[model samples]
Target: MELAQRVQSLTPSSTLAITAKAKALKAEGHDVIGLGAGEPDFNTPNHIIEAAKRSMDEGLTKYTPSGGIPALKSAIIDKMQKDQNLTYNQDQVIVTTGAKHALFTLFQVLLNKKDEVIVPAPYWVSYPEQIKLAEGNPIVVQTKEEQQFKLTPEQLEQSITERTKAVIINSPSNPTGMMYSKEELQAIGEICLKHDILIVSDEIYEKLIYTEEKHISIAQLSDSLFNQTIIINGVSKSHSMTGWRIGYALGQAKIIKAMTNLASHSTSNPTSISQYGALAAYNGSDQDIEEMRSAFSDRLEKLYSWIVDIPGIHCEKPKGAFYLFPNVKQAAALCGYDQVDDWVTALLDEEKVALVPGSGFGSPENVRLSYATSLDQLEEAANRIKHFIEKHKG
Candidate 1:
């Protein structure tokens, strides 16, 4: 049997593969400590969960508008206004299965065959694959770790071409957890306006910042940029609602309408319960959000110190998100391995500590270790990692 060419071009998710191997090791009675999580270890807030239950109890379990229920759309609108001072109508938003699904849907509606989308390297693993699945070309520009793994205005200017349609900017980035500052965004936005390219601003990790610096959307830099940018975000990262599967896109009504039309035939509507839960998430108190963010901050500080203390291992402290991306190439070299991925494999085998290799995220020298676990687990994982490096070092 022949697979579709698009499916053939798709790369399997390394995150899931590592997770499966870790699970298998655990089942075999090994004390495996997996650090590949992409979701919060916390449960969804009680209020949000209660709201979902009340909605079902009131018989609101039926399908909703393909874009989203109006109340939920209004809640999302209020969130943007309160958080980013950006406003949008119900028609300008479409709730999808998840933020990942929202991104996948946006690419489907926005791209033509061979249309190019600029992706910064060390990107979220899904970005390139989703672009290719939509028959669009992903133009990945490698970013420097010294620059906090951020894309520069100079790099963005050089990467644009006639075929360029859009570029993705994931702030409070996934693997690296670095964010773009307001001035940096303004510079990047100007280049986009100059080149007449679309800005795909992904702010799903907006509420998880660990630093004094705030998250800035490229859209809010100016009116023109706001119009030129499409914002993709969701309750997943912010509200500890990963399993709820509610994410959305905000932009021009025309683009939202087209995406809605495509979604109507596809997912029809995001799960009705998830939308209600998200509505409560936006409408309720933010105490839970702050508590979760604080926990991540503590983990970031402690785990980072432990990771960098290992021989030949170096890491830059991330400002947001729950992952620490450490440069392990020198460690791998010291261990007599040519590839960091192989070093990752050896670590899992020898220490029963699982981590996602950086090769999958478009950087071959680093590895992503998620700290979205208890402090005890994080400390134990750090010890095992330090032990592995010490034992294998030349």
Candidate 2:
């Protein structure tokens, strides 16, 4: 069967593959410790769940505007004004199925054939593929762990070309869990403004920071920067509402309207009840979020300490998000594998532990492990990993 050339060329997400494999092993009665998922281990807050129930009772399960209901949009606007010091009218925001969908729609609306989007190395797995789906070329700028895996202004300036259309910035980054400071964001935002390139700020992990390092949206740096930036965020990560499929984008009304029109024809209207649930998440107390962040912080510290003790494994302490991306280049060689992916496969097979190799995240020397699980499970997983390394170390 002939498939679309675009679909044929797409790379499957390594995170999902390993997670599925882990599940398969677990189903076969193996005690698999899967660490490949990127979601919080917490359940949705009670208030949010109650909101969804209320929506259903009120017959709000029907279709809504493709861009989202006004109540949710208002809640999002309030959040941006309070949290980000950025204000936007309703016309400037469009709600989509998830932050991923918001980005996919934006890329479709913003890019032309062969247009380039500057993606930093160790990026979220979906960015490059989404750009490719939109027929845009991804210009990957590599960042080092020593520098906290952040793209420098000079690197951003170097990656831009006449065909460059936009740059995607993920604070509290997915694979690395490192965030850009306000000054760093300002510098990068300035370069994008100077180049007249759009900035796509993915702030889905905004509330997951674990250090003194705060999450700053590149769009919030300055008025000029805000004008040229599109902010993508949702309650998925912050409120543990990943399954609800409610995310949104905020930007210039023109771009947002185009994205909304695209959404209209495609995924016309995100789930109605989910939008209500997200509104509750935004308006309710952030206690649940803070609690989850605290748990993740503790797990990160313990996991980092354990990782450092493992021979041939090194990683900078991740300041945010729930994952630890450790450089295991030497570990792979010790395990007699040339590629980290093969080493990951061997570890999963031998130890029943799942990890997403960094090759898919554009860093072949490392692997990502999510700490979004119970502390006991994490400790056991750490022990298993250490034993695996000890057994394989040459």
Candidate 3:
């Protein structure tokens, strides 16, 4: 059997790959401590679960509009207005299977063969692969650990060429947990505007921020940029509804329409019951989200301290999200591994601690550890990782 060239060229998500390997080990009675998966360990809030139950009991388990149900769309609009101070009509929003789907849909609609997208180094594992699957070239811009792993305006400007179509900005980024300030976003927005390039702002972790720094929507900076920016958000990270598979994109009417059309031909609408659950999520009190964020922040701080104590490992204090991307080149060298990927594989095999290698995200000497688990699990994982390094040291 033969597959299409596009499908054959694509790579599977490394994050999920690591997770599956960890799960398989656990099934064989190994005590695997997985820090590779991105989703939180918490159960979905009770109110959201009740909303889904009510939808099922009311027989609302049917198909919705391809672009999403009107009620959910309206709720999303309201939430965006209140949270990001950005206004959008129902026509400008389209809910999909998840933020991943929303991003793929946007890329499918907007990208042409050979068009370019600028992705910062240590990006989410899916961004480059998704862009490649869309037949778009991914131009990577390297950002240093000293810079907090954030792309500067100059970096963004330098990466733009005649074939550039869009630039992806992931705040509270996947592997790094780095976020951009309003001023930083404004500067990059100006550069995109100068080149007439689109901004794909992935803000799925907007509600997961720590520190006193606030998340800023690039679309809210200016009317001009608003028309050129597509905001991707979901209930998975914020509401602990990963299994619900509810996410939405907000952008210009034409872009939204294109994405909706693509979705219509593909998955049609997201699950109707899940849409209702998402509606409840947006309309419900944000107090639940605040509590979760506070808990994650506490766990993240504890994990950060533990990681820095490990010899040959250096980590930055992330201001948002629940993951830490630590530069472990020294650790890999001490362990006599030539690559971070090899080190990660050995750690999972020898220590039963699962983590994603940075090579999958455009960096070859780092590793990403997600602190989405309980504080106790995080502490144990850190200790195991430390022991693994010390035991293998040259």
Please give the lDDT score at residue 314 for candidate 2.
89
Show how many residue pairs clash in every candidate, following the order shown: 0, 0, 0
> Would you list the rank order by TM-score, best first?
1, 2, 3
Candidate 1 to truth, TM: 0.99
Tell me which residue pairs clash in candidate 3.
none
- Per-residue alpha-carbon lDDT of candidate 3 for residues 193-229, written as tens digits (9 for 90 to 100): 9999999999999999988888899999999999989
lDDT of 3: 0.92
Over 171-263, each residue of candidate 2 has an lDDT whose tens digit, in order, gives 889899888888898888888888899999899999998888667888777889989999999989999999999899999999999999999
TM per prediction: 0.99, 0.99, 0.98
Q: How far is candidate 3 from the true structure (C-alpha RMSD, Å)?
A: 1.0
Q: For model 1, how does the per-residue alpha-carbon lDDT over 117-162 read when each residue is reduced to its tens digit?
A: 9999999999999999999999999998899999999999999999
Q: Clashing residue pairs, candidate 1?
A: none
